[model samples]
Target: MSSLILGIESSCDETGVALVRLPDGGAVPQLLSHALHSQIDMHRAYGGVVPELASRDHIRRVLPLTEHVLKESGTTLQDVDVVAFTRGPGLAGALLVGAGVACALGAALDRPVLGVHHLEGHLLSPFLSEDPPEFPFIALLVSGGHTQLMRVDGVGDYAILGETIDDAAGEAFDKSAKLMGLPYPGGPELSRLAEGGDPEAFKLPRPLLHSGDLDFSFAGLKTAVLTQAKKLGDDLEARKADLAASTQAAIVDVLVRKTLTALKDTGMRRVVVAGGVGANKLLRAQLNAACAKRQIRVHYPELHLCTDNGAMIAMAAAMRLQAGREQAEKTYAFDVKPRWPLDSLK
Candidate 1:
């Protein structure tokens, strides 16, 4: 009595479609196949996301990608038992594209539809990895617009330990990269440029390094990067790599120290890092070294699954249904939550 679940994710600039098989027995759901299309190239020209363009692109990509996934999986739309989609905390127009498509598909097939929280998809993404984690681990979620530490006991059981007060770690990287005149989607570019530079060449601020709490603040770090760039007016180009490295170092230092603090406070040796920033090589290297020193276990989403993807959405929906935490409804009526809070998913 296995069921095929179709998932769609269009919360932002990426259009992702995936199919997952939910087992009737007590076992993990298996990913059948997935397809993704990133609007990075298009957004690059604009230097950032354009909401209307994003929504339009999502509309064009979702169906084709869904077809691609089904073909790769050797499945048909008629075989799908449920349709799942990202419903909130994203661009309003972009979200509607996914929700509308998912609900319409569900209605046409006379199947149930489930709307998943975007962050929950990220939180549960690592389950798709070869080495999945056990329950009750500390989760460090970092991305372009988010940074938080959470205590995850199980599906739908999450407690926020700390979160960003202003900018997130990803913003620190991207903004700093921009200040250095790097291209759009600056974080990865900055990381690459940093490879040849001395991380200690420039002194950058580690905001809230000792806030006595788990909360984070990276807004000031962005300002510091701007100040440094201006100070190097004539030599900025030659020293850009060093600045990038320094900025990355400062951000990583704060993230690692705060994560360690959270680990110590919770006495949990296992940690899960999710979201786009989880793909950062330096962060992974530093975190690995730090965790190994403490003899702690760290789990991550497969590299391909680190970013926003429909696979995570499908897996999350399947798990939620299996856990009996939520139900797919026949009513296809839907709305998007562009500002939904993760903790509020409580």
Candidate 2:
């Protein structure tokens, strides 16, 4: 018999739900339906996400989104055999909304429930793509709150090779963009502006590039952007595109070099890039070129899957369920880990 799983993700500003069907003895999983609600407009005025607002918005959207997924999948809630949700490493209030909804639904249905790690969901997202990487690959997770490299030996077996000591790569992009007067969630906006600008126009430091460790640091890079912006004076907007281009180039340079180094250090021929920054065109291009030169394979989630979404959460839950991973007990009530470490989970 086939098993259907309902997955909910509210790790950040996005509320996502996906229904995945696991077939009997199948090598690949099937994606039934998925829905995502972005809170970009809600948080745009504030220049970034506010946890309380994000949590409230999630509560309002999750159920409807779940309904949409079920309807689109042509499956009723009663047919769902398992419930999955993102448990931690995100906003405490946000995680609670997902956890509460998932647990409640699971209990009402008398089904098992699993709490997934947000980063793990990102790491496994590539598997949902057409060309999935083989086992024992390296993963570079670069998002708003994190930047890390890991060695994935198998399902649920993740080894942290290196990570950021300061602000994450995505944070750097957003911060730099803000310094250039870009709006909230400036990372993508910054990348767009970078298209017409000369990447070499500004000389920005690649923080910790020579640290000799896989660990990264972008706080200094952000400072460099700030300094440059201040020097540009009142006409900062006129040079905004160029500034964006230069900043992005600096960041991509460091990320590409470090990822290549990690691949070489671990002797892993396959690499998977995840998180919001994974969508950066420059980073993707550079990584592709670098990996091609070394005959190393690179994997990425579909563009839509690159960001925080429910499909990754659902897919990850399916894998854990198949592996017989422990389930959250009915009485097990927990909150989010605002600072959960991926290594700690491992």
Highest lDDT against the true fold, candidate:
1
Model 2 scores a C-alpha lDDT of 0.89
* Candidate 1 Cα lDDT to native: 0.94
What is the per-residue lDDT of model 1 for residues 1-346, given as tens digits with 9 covering 90 to 100?
Answer: 9999999999999999999999998699999999999999999999989999999999999999999999999999999999999998899999999999999999999999999999999999999999999998999999998999999988989999999999988888888888888999999999999999999998888888998999999999999999999999999999988988899999999988999999999999899999999999888999999999999999999999999999999999999999888999998899989998887764
Off by over 4 Å in 1: none
Error of 1 at 176 (Å): 1.1
* Model 2 lDDT, residue 93, Cα: 93
lDDT of 2 by residue, 1-113 (tens): 88888889998899999998877784666789999999999999999999999999999999999999999988899999888899878988999999999988988888888
The parts of candidate 2 lying over 4 Å away from their true place are: 327-334
Error of 1 at 290 (Å): 0.9
Error of 1 at 135 (Å): 0.3
User: What is candidate 2's TM-score against the reference?
Assistant: 0.97
